[model samples]
Target: MYKIISEETDKSGMKVLNIDKSDLIELMEDYKDRKYFLSSITGVDMKDHIDVIYHLHNFDKNDYICVKVSTTDEKVPSITKLWKAAIVDEREQYDLMGITFEGHDNLRRILLPDDWVGHPLRKDYDLNKVQYVSVDRDGNEHVSFDDKEGW
Candidate 1:
């Protein structure tokens, strides 16, 4: 059995189960054969590594278990192979935190542009500004959108 943590929530007490990244599917498949369904999948950026959180609940046990996958290589295990709901959340995590879900059938940018560089949700992100677009030296005029908005 995986170690469980009792995380305090505003709504009351919520039990949290912590599982290793490599064994995520193993944990899922254990209860999966008993029909435990997935509830949610999301991520938190921790600078050097990204933490992908997966929440699954068992109707029979009435308990919630979570799995965390962390990696600095930008490659993540494909939980999409087990849980279809992970498709969107994994894409969003990749787009925002730059965590690549390896082995995913179709992993792509979900919210930001395909060419967008850098993860927006990382702890090291600069909040003072989104990002400065480079000035086009090819005779194109550059104007700050804020400056023209007054017109």
Candidate 2:
């Protein structure tokens, strides 16, 4: 019971449906019951808002579809309950794009250190201020702006 804001076919001939954030969980649950597996989850910082995209595939039918939900608050429903693969996919999106997957069991940096500052994939991420990451003897990673401490 979700409304599709818009629908279009991408260059790859895959159907893409843009929907409201509130409809994501309900729609994905239906797709899961129909045997559609999650292919990936990614986010795009649209300057004004963020677009969280979910790619689903039905192997039995050899079909692919993408569900997109736009959020200015950078938050959306987590699909990890429906698809286990979404655990890592959502984490990557959260780490890189700063999109928070609400109801996620563990939403944290997957690629970057816990102390890493700023989401690098965002449109307004500062590139001039350099950050560094280093590992200690205990194998714990640390992020720092001071070059000497990081190195």
Best by lDDT: 2
What is the Cα-based lDDT of residue 80 in candidate 2? 88
lDDT of 1 by residue, 1-151 (tens): 5443333333445545555566666767776787777887777876667677777788888977666666667676777777788788888878887777778888888766555556778888777654333345564333342444223
Indicate the residue-level lDDT of 5 in model 2. 91
**Candidate 2 structure quality by residue, lDDT tens digits, 10-40:** 9988999999998999999999999999998
Against the correct fold, how does model 1 do in TM-score?
Answer: 0.70
lDDT (Cα atoms) of all candidates against the true structure: 0.68, 0.92
Quality of model 1 by C-alpha lDDT: 0.68
